[model samples]
Target: MKLKLCVSNTDVLLSTLSAIQPLRKLCVLRFTPVHLCIISMALNEPQAWCKISQEVFPLYEVESIRDNVLCVETNIDPLINALRNFDKSNSDGLSIRLQRRPVANEGPESSKKNRSMAVLSLIYTEHVSMASSRSYSFKIPVKVLKAEIDQGIVEPQLTHAEVLMKLDRDILPLFRRIERYKRSGYICVTGTNRGRLELSIEEDSRKVQLSWKEFLQVQQLEGETQQQSQFSTQDQDMPHSVQIKLKDWRLGAKLTELCYKVVMIISENHALVLHCILNEDETAEVTYYIGGKIQDQE
Candidate 1:
């Protein structure tokens, strides 16, 4: 159902997975209408926490950790029901204290003192009305926290802005013309203003050159599929017009695992073309671009 986990210490975020791995596996195999929520409390502001929620239903693959954000995919309705049930249950303070303290599980037994820690305070809800009636909560203690931390388990730091900036400056600049075309939204030939020119890219050599008008006309006569989508449509739709030019363009690079799609416009060479860099959907963590046409260089 609905699970709420709060971490007070900022550094604990790293080992979150390993620390909860045991519990997660158990819950995954057992819980119904799976929905999970995580809240990270501010170190300075003890009362404030960043909360994220997701549904975990029909026990599937173990989702990997990335960008300090945990993602879980499952059906929505069941998770919603679980959340409802969580709210139904009421409580003043979480209940997680040992009756007579068990022996220290690690190191010397008497040397260690057992301290109470709240790993997570979970709640489950059923229907919008009756859901709140069947809820439960659990708080993990400090001993478990220490064990997880010592194991060095967690996700890497999130430097999305820095990563994107580096990609634009270093990687995209190598194929300045191609990047420009991708942003502009089309592939056009230089020096042909009235008639459309055919363009082709060499896969092996990575070279590019304009095709003859006759060649394109022949293809057209042969009923070959031609790009009917006008590039001007994109330019006209842009809030502002910024033209980019290219010289002897070629497919310089292919991007994979990109979270966002970006469009750029280049200036000076005297033609406008739009190009797209493939985002394989694995590497990128954030959506970089949302709009279709870009307006003037920043």
Candidate 2:
């Protein structure tokens, strides 16, 4: 299998991955002719799932072994370390390729190892060279696991009561402020007929609420409009809140510096979904799913 893609904005891609690096240790990378996706799932309960996507990476060229799909599992740190070396300013362009290295025969009398090493070749050119362009490459060894990979992309199912809203401002600042109060907090989100949205956090006896009176845009998913219509008069005006671990919410904040916009979906008492747009064109995006915290009974 051969796969290569020329990255248009290396910084954006690297930053997105770095933001997700803390989510899990191992990441599953799936490559197709049209897109490249990085997926991670937390092993423990209150599990977190993230999927980062890059559509047309300036250039996309691929030759797959099985039905045009290639999946590999690799350590996240090493890949991030290798990619951080890229000098976005002086670099012309970056291209990544998947290759296999043949096992070397140790001796004439000994048989060669049957296993081949899978490597990711990252090649970038330095435009600083005057007479001749200098090219540097790093070959990172990645493990090709025998485990079956999911070919289709899947997101956590949302209930009818879920409210999805687009934020006009960056959420990092708000998240940072809440971090000082506690390690986790409940997010109470409310929408009004006047197109205003409010996000609040309550702790101890203090309640902090931030409002965007004219800055929010409500997004209607496939059946969301019909669902909203079913809401009773009081339910439509009441706040929809979900409890989330601050640690997990911080992960979404890390992407704020790299992503241009953040869209949040809160399922009252169920889950919090964050969809981050990484580029101006909105072609690149990352979605995060964090299960909500359950409140204690009164």
RMSD after Cα superposition, model 2: 4.3
* Local distance difference test values of all predictions, in order: 0.26, 0.65
Q: Worst lDDT window (10 residues) for model 1? A: 215-224
Clashing pairs in 2: none
**Local accuracy of candidate 2 as per-residue lDDT tens digits, 1-298:** 6777777566666766776777876777777565567777653323334334445477777666677777777777867766777754478677888877544655544333323348788888877657777788878777654324454434456764456777645545655665565623455545543245666677777887777545457665546545556765423554567767666766665655557887777776777777778777766678777777776778
TM-scores vs. true structure, each candidate? 0.20, 0.77
TM-score of 2: 0.77
What's model 1's lDDT at 209? Answer: 47
Model 1 alpha-carbon miss at residue 93, Å: 16
